[model samples]
Target: MRVLVVSAPLVGHAFPLVPLAVALRDAGDDVLLATGGGALAAADAGLPVHDVAPGFDFGRIALRVLPRHPLVARAELAGTAGTRGAGLLFGALNDQLTDPVVALADRWRPDLVLHEPFAVAGAVAAARLDVPAVRQENSLFDGRELVRATGARLGATLRRHGLTELPPPAAAIAVAPPSVAVQDGWPMRYASYVGGGELPSWLREPGERPRVLVTRSTLTGPGDRGPMPAVVAAAAQVDAEFVLVRPDGRSARSLPGNVRVVDWIPLGEALPASAALVHHGGAGSALGALAAGLPQLATVGPGDRRHNAELVARRGAGLALRPRDVTAEALTRLLTDDGLRAAAGQVSREIAAMPAPADLVPRLAALV
Candidate 1:
């Protein structure tokens, strides 16, 4: 079978789909990835890719769409407001992608289409080609609700392609642990894929003290060091070694004595060696920490970060702190709190109990 995989132009939207795509490929299915922006990094995982939106600027689109909705701009979008914002933002993204993705799908003649929730363009293209499309949840939010909200924005695109409305996916792939977010559909273990990078020799083993892994969002500009400086400052007061990922333009001379910086490394490689994690509450980072059984401190940011962080805290696996609330005490608790560690371990076990990606290949094939 030939499968066409579609993703929004962000790593948070793209990377989560990698494990399943790889599993399908290993099972003798041909898989082609269609995406843009930060998601282009997925090619580093060795998947065949087609850029659906050549020279598209998603950041610019976000800037144009977000401010039009004040609540969304402030990250206060929730309930109906959240749904509207998701439509305006992700709908705009899909609008740019729909034509190109449909063209690609028309040429590829895929038997199945797999997509992250935000990449509704995949669903559209699949409908156009009269093929089965599957929704893969990559975060804690409801994929159905988000997709429903995108309907109004996609009307023109749908009309252009002879679709009255977006069809529901043939099936859904659920990865979040039930303790954090209860979801329906085939349960697959959340797998972390942080792309390829050179691992520093020092990272191969545990450090002299407990190691705390710290990271920020990949979507931000190099100058936007959200909550990282505070985490680094708190590292100076703690006894543990801090490994900061992609610290961007920050220099070694200005960093704390106990902090180490790496431009990039796979979290799959970094988590096992670390005692705890500190990061902006991206869906990928939060799930990666839980899968590793590591206590984490999720500094809440805009959009789904708050939702992801709150779920982590409510489940007793971690804490959600505002940027100003990030301090030495919270950082220390991430390493020293036994209850947090235990809860994290429990979540990890729950994740482990889910079906592996390879195990779901036959089920997806049956759909085809």
Candidate 2:
């Protein structure tokens, strides 16, 4: 089978598709990954790549909301109204890339098209070609519901665009643990959970001192421009050594003697030894920590971080704090809290026993 995978521009949005693409290739299916950014990373991983037109500028939207209030910004972006923002963002994105995507579909003529929810243009193109189109949602938010809810609010706009009829996805594959609830009343015939990806190489090792991994999600990149400084400051007060992953190297400033910053490290290499993690609570990061059984300190910035943080706290695996208000004292409390650590361990064990991506492939095959 020939499969064309459509992904968004950001690394966070694109990376979750890697394991599935690799699985498809290994199974003797031809897989072509089409993305706007992180094409090099995917190509380096041995997946065939096709560069599509650039998607939306959510980074600009994030910058607009970060400094003023991370929580409110996140709420606005992830809430029902924010779904409209997503639709507008992708509608403009689709408008920009429609011609190229249509051309690609015409040329590639794959058996199926798998896409990130934000890459709506791929969905439209697949429809135009009359091929099966499946959406892969890797984050905590529900895209089908978000889009459906947004469509209700933008009924006139949707009607104006002749989108009154909802397009049923061939499948919606969610990459979350089974512990997470799949939304009720969604079209289950086409919607299923596939679970999260494997640990990166770095988290597999055992270390002496308790390690604390700090990152601002893959999308935040490595720039002093994000909330890392606050994490560094808070981490300085803890007993553990910090393994900081700033792949972009934009955030290398005066560092504490105990803090070590690297451009990149496999999360699997670091998480096993780490007693706790501090992150912006992207779904991948949160699930990585859960897989490792590490307690978390979530300094939620934007997007699904707030919801992920709430899940973390509800699961009793960690504490959630606002980026603006995070302090060394708070970090120390979460790291040293025994009950939280034990609870995190329980959650981790639960995640570890769940099915991996390898197990999800057949289910995905059934979807196709």
RMSD per candidate (Å) reads: 2.0, 5.4
lDDT of 1 by residue, 258-323 (tens): 998887787778788899988888888999999999999987666677788899999999999887
Q: What does candidate 2's lDDT look like per residue over 177-251, in tens digits?
A: 445435322222111112234545545654565677787655543221334667666666767677777623544
TM-score attained by model 1: 0.95
Question: Candidate 2: misplaced stretches above 4 Å?
Answer: 54-84, 149-166, 178-206, 220-227, 247-251
* Candidate 1 collision pairs: none
Error of 1 at 189 (Å): 0.6
Q: Model 2 scores what on Cα lDDT? A: 0.64
Range of the 10 consecutive residues with the lowest summed lDDT in candidate 2: 185-194
**What lDDT does candidate 1 reach at residue 188?**
93
Model 2, residue 367: C-alpha shift (Å) = 4.6
Clashing pairs in 2: 202-268, 202-269, 202-270, 203-268, 203-269, 203-270, 204-268, 204-269, 224-251
